[model samples]
Target: MKNTLIESFVFLFERELDKLEAEIKQYPDEASVWKLEGDIKNPGGNLCLHLCGNLQQYIGEQLGHSGYQRNRPLEFSARDVSRAQLLNEIQKTKLVVSATLRKLDDESIRQMYPEEVLGYPMTTVFFLTHLLAHLGYHLGQINYHRRLIGR
Candidate 1:
């Protein structure tokens, strides 16, 4: 059961990565940086950065001990990052997630997560599913932002 659950999460992450890559390719270079309104924050580029940072920090560093140093603020603030750069980051994230999940056994998956996330205590499996949901949420936003602003 644990192995199946982990496999499902890996699949989710991979699917979201594919969606993100498609959105990036679909949007024009200029449009990738466009925001719908001044108050409507987080362009596709920043969202992509945020997603990569979020996964790398939570799963790679905390779970897999990958020593990823997350700059949460920079994820939201960076701008005009090229599609190629974003794609590269996505690929790296994919590798990290795959390796991390592959290393987990049933016992590890059921262990308490290293830290409290979102003000809650949970098992590693629960936290991973939460992160996967978060990824999908942002991936949807990126897709919509691209379609709305893309030329």
Candidate 2:
């Protein structure tokens, strides 16, 4: 069960990374950083940054003790980060999440998550599953955002 969960999470992360790559290829470099007029909020570059920081902080640091520090606000506020840099961060995040999950035993998977997220407590496996869902949700948004504005 633990192995299955680990495999599924890794697969999802990979898919997310692939979608980001495709978005980078499809959208104009400037469009990648553009938020639509009015209340659209959060361009693709920020979403990519948020995804990297979230996984690095939650899974890598909290669970695997990887010593990552998350700057949550910066994840949304920073702008004009290059696609190459974002892709590189995504690759690094994949490595961190993969290494962290590989080190976990079944017992560790069943243990409580290291911190409260979304104002609740849950097991490590449960939190990881939630994080996977979060990744997919944002990946879809990025896909749509690219299509909505891409040339």
Candidate 3:
């Protein structure tokens, strides 16, 4: 029963992640990728990269794999990524995330992490939820920025 619930949550999360990635891939790279509107907090590609980086990092470590390079510069460095490239990256990340979540049974989720990892006290579950929320918030920002800069 518990396993089913966790899997369901993970499936739903992955579904939402897929939706956001699809929306982002629709962005016109020439204009929308680097456009930081006057009021927007972050550009579209940066937000996408942030989500991508964090997802890659967390899912990789949790699955006993090496993570993406924690290079903040690369997130924003490529301002002209083609839509196909962006979507391809997103697809790769989605597979990683889905696999990680699938393996995280209730016991694994209940596992504790060293406080040093987070700079504060938090269980693995807490961190997982935090990352999900972080991704969603940034995705919203990207969507808003898209509307503002997109025609």
TM-score of 1: 0.91
Measured on C-alpha atoms, candidate 3 has an lDDT of 0.71
Ranking by TM-score: 1, 2, 3
Query: How does each model score on TM-score?
Result: 0.91, 0.89, 0.84
Off by over 4 Å in 1: 1-3, 34-38
Question: What is each predicted model's overall lDDT from 0 to 1?
Answer: 0.83, 0.80, 0.71
RMSD of 2: 2.1
lDDT of 3 by residue, 1-151 (tens): 2346458657766876787777776676656776776876568777777677777777656443655566667886767666666777777777878777787677777777433456877777777777777888888887778877875
- Backbone clashes in model 2, listed as residue pairs: none
RMSD of each: 2.0, 2.1, 2.5
Which has the greatest lDDT? 1
What is the Cα-based TM-score of model 2?
0.89
Model 2 is weakest, by summed lDDT over 10 consecutive residues, at 31-40
Displacement of the residue 149 alpha carbon in candidate 1, Å: 0.3
Q: Write the per-residue lDDT of candidate 2 for residues 1-151, one digit (tens) a residue.
A: 3246666666676677677666766677664555664566987788889989999999899988998989999999888777778878888888898888778766778889878887898999889888888988888878777877664
